[model samples]
Target: MELKKSSSKQEEVEEIRTIEKPIDDSFLITWESPTDPKNPKNWPYARRWVQLVIVSVFALLGPMASSMVAPCLDQIAERFHIENSTEKALVLSIYLLVFAISPMISAPLSEIFGRRILLQAGNVIFIVFNMACGLARTKAQMYIFRFLAGFGSATPMGLGSGTISDLFTPEERGRAVAVMSLAPLLGPTIGPVISGFIAEYTTYKWIFWSTTIFSGFVFALSIPFLTETYPKTLLGRKARKLNKIEKTLKYHTEWRLEHIPQRKLVAPALMRPLKMLTTQPVVILCAGYMAIQYGILYLVLTTYPVLWTHDYNERPSIAGLHYIAPGLGLILGSQASGIFIDKTFRFLKKRNNGKMAPEFRVPVILLGTMFFPTGLFVYGWTAKYHTHWIGPDIGAAMFNVGLMLGWRGIQTYLIDTFIIYAASSTAVACCIRSLAAFGFPLFGQTLYDHLGYGWGNSLLAFIVLGSSIITCSILWFGGKRLRAMSDMVIFKDE
Candidate 1:
């Protein structure tokens, strides 16, 4: 028997050969053919886009909730009798703490159980606990509810990236990953804007309540529409279905069977993200740069309300509107990255004998390196001197544009590099960035207090500038070599 290759360009579905196999034999169960409709990569553009939209919406909810409370931290602080900046920031940062932790568990589990279940379950958990956050009367209740809700929120962060990896090929992933990623960065910006007005006009509790309500609608949409896409899990299901037909006879359950003892699979699956983080240079550098970018983004977001409300003497409502500046910039970055990343990949692929490596994604971040620090320098100094509000907003928009480009580039590169274990690789990145996001804001007030906005932000800007250089150099000059040495297969476009 001869092995059949995929027609779409990569050997993505090698197990899914054209020739049929006996389920009772040792052959692996897979899609019927290269063009099998069941294969998500082969899904029609319309169908895949629907999945992208649903997951992106689910993805948006988590990061949105993470920062929605930013505009209303003061209101909550007052209600709970909290008196310190750290504690006030705790109300927001506690959510991010778990946001860093849950992806390790969720991403690995998605590899085991499938993506749909994790996405839906996490959303339900978010809806219930988020509503509880709105209902909480004490700081204790709010903290617990927020932490649990964060776990729910972050589940989609890893799941969404894995889903995009499952649904799109390396060539088509630029646009898909851009949309999937826009949620987390863009969500924070969108969140504060909505909550600022709600907290000013209505009760601060409405912030959680409104998101919970919107989450309910998105949850409902996910229930009927979202389906499993993990190639391994789908193969397992297909094998089980075949097994039921004739129990007395054997099936080709030996190949990629899912009946492995949970004891055996769980520990390794859960550990994979940590293992990669410690062992893989590509993962470490991608996550490191991303963490710096994420940390600074949250630091700015947490303090944005104060900048406008205190420095500019604006009301909470008007202060909240400033998020739109960064929000639009984030959109601009994502759109621009989406447009050029694939084109760049194709151009590079042509230059390199019609083969594509994950390193092709790194060039977009070079543009990010330029914008991120410049925006930081401008925003920092302008806010320090109390320049017109528009000056700071423009600076914010510019940095945010950099944030999106850098973030999308790294995320898509990881997904492409570790195609089979995309979820685990993504979890590693999420875990690191979440930690940064959590820690950065906790010290943001103190940093600004000591150094003032200009120097403090400039410090962050310079750090990211340095990190971007290391990130680009490694990926551009050494990414292919690093990936070649990796134990996992490095997917390439042919």
Candidate 2:
């Protein structure tokens, strides 16, 4: 027993010796090491911007595919001999439904295989099915193709944030995010406009064909430029290179390729996001707010045609052009948010003694809440009373501005709060929001039919207003307490 105990103690000491300790001397910080060059954050700005553009292109393709089909839904249904408008609407919104569930798999896969591989693979999947969508002859075929395309398209949604975090420091992320964020919002708004013109001039199938061509272009462009950006993946590569160098020099380094546990790569990749989603209060609150905001966006999208065509007697082309107003709002709002979010973060960092907290972004949410109900009331009442087309357009623009602001605030807050697990954290919020986007439109027509546009929209506005107020209040007071309790923050401190 005494011999065994001595051997165990000796083994423990040897293990401790193998682990490298941090150098305390400040002079060592100035040394330029091989590892320094490999860090993505230190990469040339041109390379970083190229990566940003590639990921943004991937992000843009998904939303374009989603909404491009909107203008052609009637023609698609008629060709298939399906008469129900609600069922036809399902073909368009069901893609978003598939998107909600796919990230569960894709998010984990990105963590496992690396972001670039999954992104490229997903783009291929999207392109194939998107082509199938053009060739779909039956309603069942269309639904299946759209669902598969959506699954493929979900890759960029979750991976874009992780990529940004990998490549940019938190302080520099705002502008990159601004460009990336524009893709998804602007894609949907512009897709319908372009598709409407195509549908009017040609067959409905061209809508799918056009997106297929776009996706092909993106895929070709991404092949050379896209590279793995995840930290674990990059670090593993570095460790391997270091191991080879140590062998050549006949000197042992502290980091050993054999010492890295296989499970370290697998376990955290799968469990971290799930843990963050289930455990974090901030994630829960932000997710609920995002779900409501996305729901309202879809509600308006699904009902706009009903309001414009039936109530106002506008042509499809003209009605589609109306989307441009909201597109303009989203662009302007996103650009403004990029500037303000960074500025607010810096100001709060200074105020907090140079320590930045996630709660600093909450002010933007308050601003968004104020606009939420006001826009809804304007849109609802104007359309209900048969007011001029410009009135509803203005209302949509206002509502979209609020949506963009709220989205940017919540997204940045989540990323700031859970830097290590932001991808999974954002995934949870996105899942809930995508589900709402899918479900809200299904019932939008029914609610408008019975309650009329005015009262129905009023009810929606009230719900959003109440939720927004509650969200703002919670962030204002509870955010500080919650941030202190967060595991990510605790981990960072240690």
Q: Per-prediction TM-score, please?
A: 0.95, 0.88
Model 2 ranges off by over 4 Å: 1-21, 24-35, 244-268, 484-494
In candidate 1, where is summed lDDT lowest over 10 consecutive residues? Answer: 14-23
Clashes of each: 5, 0
Residue 366's C-alpha lDDT in candidate 2? 77
What are the per-residue Cα lDDT tens digits for candidate 2 across 1-494? 01111221222212122212235422111112322555576688899889988998898888778888777788888899878877888888989998777776667667656789889898999999989988998999999999999999888888777777667765666677777777877887888888778767888888888888988998998888888876556555545565576654222223332245555766666676666667778878898999998888887876776677678887788778988988887887788778877787778767877555667787877777777677888888898898888888888888877887778888877776665456677777878888999999889988999998789889998998899889888887888777666675421321
* Model 1 CA deviation exceeding 4 Å by range: 1-3, 11-27, 253-255, 261-264, 489-494
The weakest ten consecutive residues by lDDT in model 2 span 1-10
- Estimate, for each residue in 1-494, the C-alpha lDDT of model 1 and write its tens digit: 34455456454543233233434445456566567788887888999999988989998999999899998888899999999878888999999999889998999989888899999999999999999998998999999999999999889888877888778877788899888888888899999888988988998989999999999999988888988888778777777667776552344433444556556788878888888888887788888888889998999889889899888999888999999999999999999989878898889888998666888898899988989999999999999999888899999999988988888789889988888688888898899999999999888988999999999999999898999998899888988788876775446334
